[model samples]
Target: MVLASALLATLGLVSPVSAGASKGVELGASDTEGVTTSATPLRGTRGVSSYEGTGVPSDVTAYGAQRVPAGHRIEGYSSPTGDDFGTQSIIGADGRVRVDPTTSFPARATVLITRTVSGVERLHCTGWMFGASLVLTAGHCVFNQSTGWYTGQLRFYPGANGTTYPYGSCTAATLRSNTGWTVDGSPDADYGGASLNCSIGNTTGWYGAYWTTASLNGTSTTIQGYPGDKSQQQWIHSDQVRASNSLRLYYDNDTVGGNSGSSVHTVRADGSSGCSGRCSLAFHAYGVGSGTHNSGPRITESRFNLVIGWR
Candidate 1:
């Protein structure tokens, strides 16, 4: 049985493993020195190059047909009073266990949740960069009294460490979670709940809602995230499943806290069914990490529609 919310409150976010900073790790390459040739970019076969690795496990594989119940929920990692919602886990290219990579889709829709604890500001959870001024993450990450949202200090980095891309960060102006998520930890009701009208202590202004959908299940995808408490830690994993709107992947790899809000992406390999070179099809915005059961959730397009419409 899962731990109760009260029991989980004592289990603050687990610290993730750390990897020294390097703009990004190179994937599927022969050596780190040469001009670096991009691989064929196969959906399920591409290897992650830049991020840290916890050593891949032998169980990683395509998902089976287990569906997450609509009633599944978890206690908020940061919020003592909030309920925890269920999410999907992913494996990074480094073979380390991480959260869903689909969250990185649409590129600019991912964000990093920075907060203040005991007057000391620190990076807390991962989030999605949505719209020109919106970022999405678990509501618990922002509203938890244990971790105060640093309205003025929060930042966002897109494709944070892609080997061929320059890194950038964005300042967050607002934060939002579903009213239900705030009440009973049932964001499942609003799994893709998003709002551009929410705010964080008036410092961050609301942009708009951007949630995910269940359409991504059974589709091939990739997951990226900073795990084990290391900033700049990233990984990529593929060959996934869309189980009840959640994207599930496998990796014996390990992940800890500070990985929340990682992005899950759809693989668009070169010469694949409909893909060409280096292009990702679509990505979900939240990195629900690998759990005790070896699964995670991916936000879907339908959820995004609901968030934008505040449905």
Candidate 2:
């Protein structure tokens, strides 16, 4: 059985293995939680999923599926935008394509994070909705060593394509992160989340997440989120998992600064062993420092349960 939320609150940050990680890790009972797999995410809405077929992709502006969901409410920025926080590295050529409708399954589930920097609200990081009111992201996106939790400084906009906010926006009633990031300052433990003031995820849907002990190399991965350079529009890139360590996964998917906190996920087929549909594998955080590949904190059994408990 899953642990209760109260117990989980004190369990995070026990250790901090991160992207651009130091060494290899071994799987343990906690890696799989005594089971082979688990799917702990609220993934799709019955009538609100947008198109993921085609469009301008990167920055050309494909206005095809700009449909907006009705009834959901809406609701902010900073540094030189994103300076030292979540740093999404771009690999080789810029092959990222703009997500045509931002309203698609994972696209709508994806979010654009902004914070106050140098007196203005600017694009900061990326996030993904995992529950009705939970948005997971890089720990750095919500907290800094010098400043601390950005309680009133951050905002989450789901399916934000340029000037359009199809699903409106949401604010955090509480900001959360593990001690690994807040105390240990570990990048491996860099992932964190927020509990929104609104339950807009009912209309926006969310991304399913799972944890596995098997090698993920060669598994097709897709990174879709708002890149800082894209002027707040959502973009996407696809690549296979290049390497899978115990705590981090590497890939060649192209990304930029603001893509931090984006979900590094795979499209598992229907009725797959552990996860199906747009299932998240890792949390995008750092650039190409762990090697030639970009990386993020992997979703292990503990982290997976941690997020679910947060919800």
Task: Choose the strongest candidate by TM-score.
Answer: 2
Instruction: Report the number of backbone clashes for model 2.
Output: 16
In model 2, the Cα lDDT at residue 3 comes to: 34
Write the residue-wise lDDT of candidate 1 on 31-63 in tens digits: 122222222321233222111111211221111
Worst 10 residues of 1 by lDDT: 16-25
Which candidate's lDDT is highest? 2
Candidate 2 residue lDDT tens string, 1-311: 12333244346633332211121122122221222221223222111111122311342112222234453222222234433233437655577787877766777778888786556777889999876678999898988888899989887877887777776667788999889899999888889999987765656667777777778899999999877666677889999998878889989988888889999988866555445667888899978752489889998766776676676
Model 1, 191: alpha-carbon shift in Å?
A: 5.9
Number of backbone collisions per candidate, in order?
67, 16
Q: What is the lDDT of residue 119 in candidate 2?
A: 61
Worst lDDT run of 10 residues, candidate 2, spans: 42-51
* Per-model TM against the reference: 0.45, 0.73
